[model samples]
Target: MTEKLFSPYQFKSLQLQNRVVMAPMCQYSVTAKDGIPNDWHQVHYVSRAVGGTGLIIIEMTDVEPDGRITDQDLGIWSDDHIPAFAKLVDGMHAHGSKVAIQIAHAGRKAQDASQPVAPSVVTFPGEAYKEPRALTTEEVVAMVHKFAAGVRRAVQAGVDAIELHGAHGYLIHQFHSPLMNHREDVYGQELSRFGVDVIHAVKKEMPADMPLIMRISAIEYADGGYDIDHTLQVARAYQEAGVDIFHISSGGEGPSGQRKPGNYPGYQVPFARRFREELHVPVIAVGMLEDAALAQAVIGNEDADLVAIGRGMLRDPYWANHAALELGVSKEHAAIAEQYSRGY
Candidate 1:
């Protein structure tokens, strides 16, 4: 039998309903500014869960104020936001989906309508960027605290797993990228130190049984920025720090990587496949994957342990259910949250 997309895969302890992970795509429809979760969040996520995604990873939520990409990002730093997210998570679980929260600090990529905030005050050749105040060492320490508190809230909200958003030039990733982090201090000089401190704090606060995954941009796609060499090194250390999975993505290539290399099916799988061998960790591959054949091929070839679908699901919310039917996925797997009598 061909391994189905919704097959249950055991990751140490937690069981994911399927390999069809809903990649964290920003919806930008939060409570706005306050970083609170509201009805919008509840509906947006539940829709995907209801649509038959195996794992419904929530949007890129902020761990702090300056982390907001726009005024519409969801936040978990405060306990007040838990009830709404709890409802969302509960509803998703009720609909038969494992949930993962993709949490991050936006760092210098913080933006308003037109202005972008960045680590150093390097003007982007006339792109109205915010003159970000370099975060003090004390402030950095506080940010770590915020991440721990956010995880606690995620646990309260009842998410099945946690995906630390360390990719795409966000706060944690910005520090990891040489182009963005220009500080001469430890954070700036030591490109890999920031993520370590974060995982250290997060691990301390998390329950031993909960699965923690790192969502990372394995390549910066830019020449002067983060590259495969640096990212692989970071992954080695991160696995040692105890993450259960590595969610791989690309871009933030600065300028050189901006060539619109038209999206091809599994365009980014090579990175994940390489990381799987180098890091020896479960890797989640996300890119232009849309077909069941291609996804099966990736998993079958051991290119990646799992495949993450973004636009494909958006194109078809019931992508997993239908794909499961076509690929003949098991209906009795533990990862199957709750199966609908009829396909979406």
Candidate 2:
């Protein structure tokens, strides 16, 4: 029987051999002290490609030095960083996996910066995160160009797609969250303005057929945070701005509250479904969806077009292969690495 999890998916000019995507997770292994991908990033991603991951989105790559959550995070601030990433992208392509890199600015969450920047001066609740200075309208405009520059570099490096990290309380989220953004300018009047501008700017640097994925926290889960309806409205704005796919995730906009999200499996599947049905767009479902059966069910039931396995992929670089085995996919469709075909 054909397994939905192992089936092919295509959108725009990007096509995946399976619905399994390796969610971007930070490695913090940049020993070079520069924002370049090193041996660790190469091995970590290539292993997933060999294991049959359909798509691998590199960790949150910052557009500026101070935009990183940690100093060790990967960056694309300059053309110098492209060659190292290009090698990894080429390797994944050789192994039958598509590659995308998530470009972002940490905003107030830049843990290592002496003073981070955000739409407002509000800092994340925890002491671990430092307070952030609000960005001037001019500065915000400048930052949009910086994000555009990052996209140009990614295209130059030949990535299959690009994802903007609009979730997890990053700079984009900060601008949209009412609790965090308290400006009186156009960005404040139009909550999605900053992100939307960034989207348009990034699009200008990309090929017409390339997919642009935006990951959004569909629910805030904190006290006084926006609800699903509110997030859906903002998502529409992003869709209008040229997002081709929505990767649904939740929380991280702020600290927990009485209305915190549940920690159960497939907790965010509903969010993904809503984006797909309501927004009329392809969606990637993530959040504790590690079980082979559950991942398959999510795609089979049409809850999401693709499933992103985070911790599961980290724990097992071959999670896709293992999932294929568990789902009883045919050997020909499994496409297990030739060197490791016997094990499968």
Candidate 3:
């Protein structure tokens, strides 16, 4: 029988050696604060490629400097930043791993910014968070262009795909969240408007065949947060706006209230299934899917088209290779690097 976890998976222009995905996790190692990826970023990602991840989604790369959670996060706001990203993309490709970048804006979550921006003046729930200034109607339109510009750079850098960070309480999420967006403009009237606009703008910059991925919170955990039903409506709008794949995750809009995020393995898998069944689009499941058997079941059970391992990959860079071996996959099928074959 073919082991679904280790089986090849493809969608649009993205073809992966296996179903394992290295979920985008912020390294916050950009010491230069100039938004350019440096040596730390290169070694960090390329090592994962060497470890055998099929798809390595580069960390939450912000579209603008102030859009970063901290000054240390990666950014693609300028033409000057393209080469650094291109080099990283090349290294990952050389290891036979496909690459994707999660373009985002941290919005009110930009803790280091002197003044952060969001759809409205509400502050993210934290003592460290500042009350963000609201973007004027004209500035909101300009922000869409900024997103397109960032995606254009990613394409030039040669990423196999692009994933927009519409999840978490970032700029996109802020615009879409009823808790965060108290605007009186058209953006306020339609929660998905900002995300749809950004999606359309970025799609224009991408190749017609290249798939566009959007990471979205399927449910919010904060008090008064929207439920899955609400997100389904929002996601439907996104799908129509040209999102080819959905990376299903939940929460990050604010602190958990009555409905806390689950703490068990495959907790988020059901959400992924819901997205797949309802929207009829491929979805990637993330959250605590580290165990080899469990990850395999997520695929074998047809819960998600792909599984993203965030902390597991961080703990063991060779998680994919190890999982393949544990699942009884042959070395040839596992594609373990020749240099590491003896060790396996």
Tell me each candidate's TM-score. 0.90, 0.99, 0.98
Q: How many residue pairs clash in each candidate?
A: 6, 0, 0
Off by over 4 Å in 3: 30-32
Q: Give the candidate order by descending TM-score.
A: 2, 3, 1
What would the per-residue lDDT of candidate 3 be over residues 75-115, giving only the tens digit for each residue?
A: 99999999999999999999989999999999999999999
Q: List the residue pairs that clash in candidate 3.
A: none
Off by over 4 Å in 2: 30-32
Once model 1 is optimally superposed onto the true structure by TM-score, how far is the C-alpha of residue 156 displaced, in angstroms?
1.7
- The model with the greater lDDT, 1 or 3, is 3
Sliding window of 10 residues with minimal summed lDDT for model 2: 26-35
lDDT for residue 206 in candidate 3, whole number 0-100? 97
Model 2: per-residue Cα lDDT over 1-344, one tens digit each: 25799998899899999999999998887484678988888889999999999999999999999999999999999999989989989999999999999999999999988899999989898888988899999999999999999999999998999999999999999898898899999999999999999999999999999999999999897899888898899989999999999999988888778787878999999999999999999999999999999999999899999999999999999999999998999988785999999897
Error of 2 at 309 (Å): 0.3
